[model samples]
Target: MESSSHQDSVDSTPVSYESSQHSQLSPSYPRAQTTSLSLSSTPVNDQAHNGYSSPATSVSPQPEEPFKAPSPAVTRKKLSGYVGFANLPNQVHRKSVRKGFQFTAMVVGESGLGKSTLINTLFSTTIKPQRLYSQPGSELPSTVSVESTSADIEENGVRLRLTVVDTPGFGDYVNNDESWKPIVDNIEARFDAYLEQENRVNRQKMVDNRVHACLYFLQPTGHSLKPIDIEFMRRLHQKVNLIPIIAKSDTMTDEEILVFKQRVLRDINYHQIQIFSAPIYDNEDEETLGENEAIASKIPFAVVGSTSLVQSAITGQEIRGRSYPWGVVEVDNEDHCDFVKLRQMLIRTHMEDLRERTNLVLYERYRTEKLLGMGVAQDPTVFKEINPAAKMAEERTLHEAKLSKMEAEMKMVFQQKVQEKEAKLKQSEEELYARHKEMKDALEKQRLELEEKKRRVESGRPLTPDRPSVGQQQSQKKRFGLGK
Candidate 1:
C-alpha cells in the first residue's frame, strides 16, 4: 500500500528522495516508495552545491498556482517612521558637509521672550547677565541693556563663534518713548546699503534686493501683529527672507500655538517661516538641503533657528544634568523633547542659502573696503584696543563689525527721540489705513443713504443730509498744508 502511495506521489514528475541506507534497506521497500512519493511535498533541502537544479524530471508538481502574497494596505505612514533609514544611508558626506556649512547669524526679536537666554545657553556661556529691570514704578531703567558679546566655542570637535544680539524689548515700554527710530533708522541704513548695492556686492548679486536673510522673532504671546513689529518687518521685507520665530514656546499651550500659527498665516503676508518655540534646535534636513547646516546658527538663535546639520543638543546618553539640565523640560507637548527639529529645519532647508550668503557678504566686504594689502591699507583704528596684529587681522572689517553696534549706539543716544518719531509715524500710518477704511465704509453708507434719500425724494419726500464725511477734517488739513 505504501509503495502504491509513493508511486502516486511521484506521478509523471519524479522526485528522487534519497537516504544513505536507502539502497541497503529499501530500494524495493514500501516505506522507501512512500518517501519517494512524498518528496514533492517536502521543502527542498539546500544541496552541497547550493544551487537548485531544474525540476525537468518534474520532482514536484507546482501548486495549483504560485503562492499569492498578501496585499499591503495603503496608509498615511511616512518614510520617517523608519529609524536610521529615515535619516539616510550612512551620512558619509554629512560629516564633511557639516564641516562645510557652519553658519553665524545675529538677529533680534521682541524683548522678554528669552531670545538672549537661548543664545547664552547654546553658547554655554553668559552673554551678558540680563539686567533685571526693577518692576515698573521703580527708578531703574526699564532694562539695562546687555552689552553685545560674542564668542567661539568648540562642540563635538567643531569650532563655532556665536554673536548673540540681546535687543531690548521693542514696543513694550509703558511710558511715551521715541527711542526705537534711530536704531531702526541705522538698521535700515545698514540694510539700505546692502539693498542699495551702490557697492558691497558682486554685480550678479547686486540685483535691487539686499541682505541674505532677516529672521524676525515673534514672542509666544498672541498672534496679533504688533504695529511696530509689522512696521519693522515691512521695511526689511524687500531685503531679507523674513523668518518669524516663536520664542518662549514652553510658555504657550498647544492650542495657543495653533491659533498663533493660524493668526500669523492670516495676518502676515510672507511665507510662514520655520515657526519654532524655545528648546527647539535647528535640525538637519536632507532632500532640499545642500548638505551642511546654516551659517545663521553661528550667528544667533534669536535671528534664525535650525539650519541643516546644526543639530540641537538634547540630553543624550553622554550628556548629564549639569551640562544640559534644561533639556529636561517638555516642548511641543512631547516629554522627550527634540530641540534638533528647529536646528535641522534651518540647517538643512536653509543651509546652502546661508553659506552662499555668507561667502557673498565676505567677498563684498573685501572688495568694497578696497584694501591694497594687509600692510598698506590696513586701518590701525581697528587694532588700537587689542594686540594690534591680532585685532587687525581679526576685524579687517571692523567698520562693518560695528554695523549693529552703530545702530545700537544711535539707539542709546536717541531712544526717546526715535520713540517719539515712531509714535508720530505710527499714528500717521494708522490714520492713513484707518482713514481709507473709514472713507470706504462711509462712501458705501453714503451711497446707500443717497439711494434711500433719492427713493424718498422720488416719492416726493424731502432729502436729509448724509452727515459730515471723514474727509471734512482731512480737507481742513489739506487747506492747512495749502496755507503752509
Candidate 2:
C-alpha cells in the first residue's frame, strides 16, 4: 500500500503508476528507460561554466518599486470639547499688567517753557522736582544742564515707572552754536548704556534707560520755529520721537496761534523734519481712527500747562485752567487749548507706542549704524521666515539687476578695449605708411643718382674733367721747373 502510494506520488505528472512500480521493483533496469520513466515535479538544476547562475533553469529577480509617501489629508477637524484657548489675549493682558511698564520721556526747551508743569499734568504725578524761583538778578546757567526725575505711579492695579528728563538753559546762552550737543550726547549716552547692557553675558537685570519721546516746547512768540528749535529738532529727530508743543499758549490770541501753527508746520515740512504722529493701525475702528486723526491734526499743540485747578466762571465748576482778567483758559478744554490732546497722546493713547518705536525703530537703526561703524558685518537674510516667497522674489530681482549691471560694465570695458586697440592699429598703420614712403623716397633718390652716373658712363664722358699724367706733367714742367 505504501509502495502504491509512493508510485502514485512519483508518477503524478507523466509516467504511469505501473511503470513506476516496475522500475522500483526491478533490481537491474535500463538507465535510459528508468531516466525517461522517472517523473519529477521539482525544477531542473543546470551547472554553469564561468559565470554565476541560479540552481534552477529559468529564474530572475524582479526589481522592487520605490516607496511613496502618503498624501496629507486636507480636512478640517471638529473639536469634540472646548479647549479654552480663546483666553490667550486675556492671559497676555494679565501677564503684561503683572509685569508693569516703564516709559522715559525727554523735555527739551528754553527756560520758562513750563516743561516740568506739562509733565506733571500729563501723568498726574509729581515726577519733576520742585525748583525755587530765582531772584530777578540771579545769574543764568552758562550751559544746558540735564536733570532726571523718576517715579512709580499705580492706578487701578497697574504700576508705571515714569521717568522725565529735563534740559535746562537750552538756547539761553548768547552764542548757542553747539547748544544741542549736550542733549545729543545725553541721548547717545543712554543708547550706549542700553547697548552695553545688552552685550553683557548676563542680562537679567538690564535696565532700559533710553529716551522714548522728546517734548520740544517752542516759545509762544506768535511766529514760527526759532533757529534753536529748528536746529535742535534737526539734530535729534532721528534719535527720538519729537512732539513739538507751543508753550504759554494763553499769551497768544486765537488768530495768532492759528497762523503760527500753520507757519510752524510749513517750516517743518520744508525742512523735512519728522514729528511724532499718532499711528492708525488697520485693526483700529472708525472712532479710534477719527480720534487719532484729530490728535494728529493738532500737532505742535498750542497748550497751556497748569498743575493747578481753577473754577470756571462760565461753567461755574472746578476745572484745570488759568484764570485771567479776560477769561479762564481751560487746560483740558479742546476749545481753549490742546493740552488735552497732548496729554492723551503722552499718556492715554500712545505711551506704549512711543516706547515701542524707540526700542524697535530708532534704537534698531542706531544699533545697526553703530555695529557697522565698528566693523561688524551681519547677514541680511538671517530672520526671513516671514514672506519667504516675497523675499526670494526680491532677492532674485536684485540678483538680476546686479548681473545686468556687471554685464553692462563688462561690455563697456570690452568696447573700450576694442576702441583702444583700433586706435593703436590706426596709429601704427599711419607710422608704417610714413616709413614706407620715406624708404621709397630715399630709394628713388639713390636710383636717380645711379641712373645719372650710368648715363654719364654709357655716354663715354669723363665723370670729372681730364687731368695731366705725372710723367707728362714732369716732362712738361721740366721746361718750367727751373723757375720754381
Number of the predicted model whose TM-score against the real structure is largest? 2
All candidates: TM-score: 0.37, 0.63
Local distance difference test, each candidate: 0.42, 0.72
lDDT of 1 by residue, 79-189 (tens): 745467545633744564355223334455655665655444333345435647668777644531322344444433333333333445455566425434433443344
- Give candidate 1 misplaced runs (Cα > 4 Å): 1-104, 124-128, 135-147, 175-183, 186-215, 270-328, 331-338, 347-352, 358-484
Clashing pairs in 2: none
Q: Model 2 scores what on Cα lDDT? A: 0.72
Worst 10 residues of 1 by lDDT: 26-35
**Regions more than 4 Å wrong, model 2:** 1-81, 136-139, 381-484
Question: 1-484, model 2: which lDDT tens digit per residue?
Answer: 0111211012211111111101111000000000001112333333332242222222223346633445668998899999989899889878978887777888888778888888777655456755666799998677777777666766655666666787777887889998999889888888887888888898877677788889999888765567777788889988898888899999998877776676667567656676777765668899988987787778779898776789999889887788899889888789989987887777777777787778776787788788889999854543223355666898999999999999999999999999999999999999999999999999999999999989999999988889999887888878887424
Model 2 compared with the native: what TM-score?
A: 0.63
